[model samples]
Target chain A: MPETIRDPADPRLDPYARMRERDLVGRSGRFVAEGEVTLRLLLGPRARFRAESVLLAPERWPGLAGALAACPAPPPVYLADKAVMSAVTGFPIHRGVLAVGLRGAEPEPGALVPPPPAPVLVLGLAGLTNHDNVGAAFRNAAAFGADAVLLDGPSCDPLYRKSIRVSAGAALIQPFARLGPGRDWLALAETLGLETLALSPGGAGGLDGPDLPTRALLILGTEGPGLEAGLLARARALRIAMAPGFDSLNVATAAGIALHALARAQGRLVPRGPNRGGG
Target chain B: MPETIRDPADPRLDPYARMRERDLVGRSGRFVAEGEVTLRLLLGPRARFRAESVLLAPERWPGLAGALAACPAPPPVYLADKAVMSAVTGFPIHRGVLAVGLRGAEPEPGALVPPPPAPVLVLGLAGLTNHDNVGAAFRNAAAFGADAVLLDGPSCDPLYRKSIRVSAGAALIQPFARLGPGRDWLALAETLGLETLALSPGGAGGLDGPDLPTRALLILGTEGPGLEAGLLARARALRIAMAPGFDSLNVATAAGIALHALARAQGRLVPRGPNRGGG
Candidate 1:
């Protein structure tokens, strides 16, 4: 059953208040999932995060009824009028669906990469400060069947609301862990015997040069500065060839291209039935 | 030399006023270029558009001095304080550089994709309404050395300021044509004897299937509703394989991956000198 919340000041709605501000500092250990697609992802069988509660406009109820019913451990549902919902959130809830998800314990980076011979594909993101890029990286990682994504301390949070939305809910489902501040991810990669392929414009060879190792980590840096000198030296550097004089593709776009190429080379992409639409 | 302006209401700055509003209806036959990099592109030798005027915060003048000096027929330059420039633009001009480029004429679709004999790769976009996606598409097209980009009427304007910024000025450098409202672009592709490959999740084969033809057009559609049935039927359907049950990649990311593949197969990517950075 759904509860009708008339007061914007209700304590139950605390996590949903002033979303923009909360996104910056985050909601302690909780994150928000927005829109119908993401909300469904939060409650899906493969969901890594547990939903604490769901908030939605009265109109969205009928559409989400089936999904809400399917939740094995249904979270509390709160229905509010659009006006009150907008007032509480400090912005218009255009999607009219939002859920608070709990972020459990952080996963260890070494466990994410595993020892060699496991046919693992891991995406390493370094100094990626943009939420959109982080989100897109997760989306691409999931799409290409990457076993995990390891982010350095400088990378933005993949669980941000906008990141979750931009990722098409991959942020919720993709297996990822952040290497705590000042940790050497490269040293970790070396210890695990994972082939590290760092993407840089000045890289020696093309991305299509050779068959990618079954266990490999594709590292991408920020757009303008690219990878640091020390990092590039340690990894086998690879570049995506571009037309003369052009700088580079957007960081997220580059990740997508490189991941696709890696997945194709390693035969990780799933074959689908004919005539089934991607969406 | 740059002229200094004191007032935000100056008639000479009319085109820049209320940029958000101007972006919707557009500045008649003009488009605004933001940031130093895009400004440099507008004044570059291979520029397709003509600069009507350049607006800058006084602080930006030093950085742009060389590019301005290199311009063959320098347009008038106006320098103003950041406050005055921001007021005139109805927003804070953080990049402190803006240029109004003239859209002289629209090129015919056929002219963009030449006759069959010449080796060519073209990108065709249909109903891609997002400015960021359009911009990224242009960036990928430029990076991968596509001959040109042809956008249908339903697609957003690649010349939009945000699009231009996102494209890293590729919108200005890349040769592109809008296939006017309701024009049959597929028919035009047929007339040009170009092989058409439409990307869809339900695509019959993987993207790496066979050697792509020398003259090929890779067509992409909007994210959710993908390419239309009629269009998909007319072109060879291809897809990027993904992990099971995931939706699709961001339209722009998909464009980047597809373009990179096509460019690699066609030997279009430019090889760069060792130790040269992409930026």
Candidate 2:
């Protein structure tokens, strides 16, 4: 139900501020979402919420609350002035809305692979601390119908507020998992029967190599370092076809272009099937 | 040219910290490039610059300052311990290197557009405060061989630190201009005889519209509340051919895909021309 909150010190709005503190959020297992648009976008079918809360301006309550009222949501909606909202969130959120939803449950990696095997763009991010790049990768992964995204060692938290917003809520829909670094992750994927294709700008072969495999994993590393030498040596390396003067594409853009190439190679992104467009 | 700096409060490093304050950067006409990778990338032919100062680890001086020493670089490099370097820039300066370069003068809008006949994807962004998206747009613009990028209204500063890094220093090379919002900007574009294409999920025809003019301007808005209605109405609206269940692609990824489509339409990004492998 909707509730008006006059005092900024209200206990119900505690989760909003708690998310900023690493220790508190880690213990509580909560994340924050700012603005009505992302909140609305995340409220689609198949959305599984663990905890959902909204801090809204008075003018925004009617329509926003009504939308929730029509749904099966029993989450709390805290109404407050813009200043109070800013005080609680630690920033001026002009989006007029915020929601703290539970992180969704992910399926086993085995289930994500398409039948008869379509090429998968596996973004192998190691030490990629920037939340925006993480989010942009998820958005790109979803746009090009990547089979799944596997996070390698020391990457930034994908559920971080900035990542979610930067990803435009794509993280909520795209399936991803932390597959820690080293030989074990590669071993597990090999066991699953997926060929690994690591992206290297200096690699001998272009990304559009001959005899496109139906089931392959495209691995990517962090921004500057490119790819880990150990991992690059283990997996088959590929390079993007580009003009000479250009050095390299941004990791996320390269990921998008790679996804497009692999999807087209496997005929996965072709406009067909259900009237509903490709996700 | 590179010197060791033991004191964290060294007065010479003020310009580095000054770049941190977003407001002061615009007023001072200065910006900082962190890491040896980006700083070197920014030192290319198209990137004109006069180094105001540089901060680097003492050990990196010999290897990193080679090209700078040959030129008439007035700004001496300031060396500091890892801890002191971390304190200067809000985030950890991973490569133990940083450089403060003057903001090079931007060319006039008319000068950026190639003299007719060629395909140009001029990204007109409005209300996109996220620096990463701006950077990603620059990255994509460069990847697609866009003639130039034009900014209007209140958009994020391209010179912002995060944007420069996210763009992989492409912001240093791509030509851009800040034109205020009005009919004049559009009129000037029309005078150049460039067909303007506004990207919207709900825009009229799909992304692969018939025979798009070779020279065109692709206007992209922030994630939600897409291109302003007035702007969309005024330009040719186009939507990407997306699958069902998918709402929209991240603005940058969408730009990459659309640019790929547009380049394909214009026959620019084909596997030919100067891209012949191996010298």
Winning model by TM-score: 1
Estimate, for each residue in A107-161, the C-alpha lDDT of model 1 and write its tens digit: 9878766576778889999999998889988898888888889988888899988
- Pairs clashing within candidate 1: none
Q: Determine the C-alpha RMSD for candidate 2 after optimal superposition of all C-alphas.
A: 5.1
The C-alpha local distance difference test score for the whole of candidate 1 amounts to 0.86
B1-279 in candidate 1: lDDT tens per residue?
A: 999999999999998899999887853799999988899989999789999999999988998989999999999999999999999999888878999999999898788876769888999999999999999899999988888999998898989989999999999999999887777757777888888989888887666756777888889999889998888888888887787767468888888888877877787777553676533
| Model 2 agreement with the true structure over A129-237: per-residue lDDT tens digits | 7787888877777666666787765777777888877777777767777764353556756866778777667555554456656777777777567776777778776
Report the C-alpha displacement of residue A61, candidate 1, in angstroms.
1.9
A41 Cα displacement, candidate 2 (Å): 4.3
lDDT of 2 by residue, B1-279 (tens): 467877777888777663456544463578777666677766545665666777887777788667565555446768897778878665566688787778767677778887777656676666677887898888888777777888775778877878878777777777788775564555777988788887777666555456777888887888766777777778777776443454557777778777766766676653433322221
Give the Å shift of residue A94 in candidate 2. Answer: 5.4
lDDT of 2 at A201: 71
User: Chain A vs. true chain A, TM-score per candidate?
Assistant: 0.95, 0.85
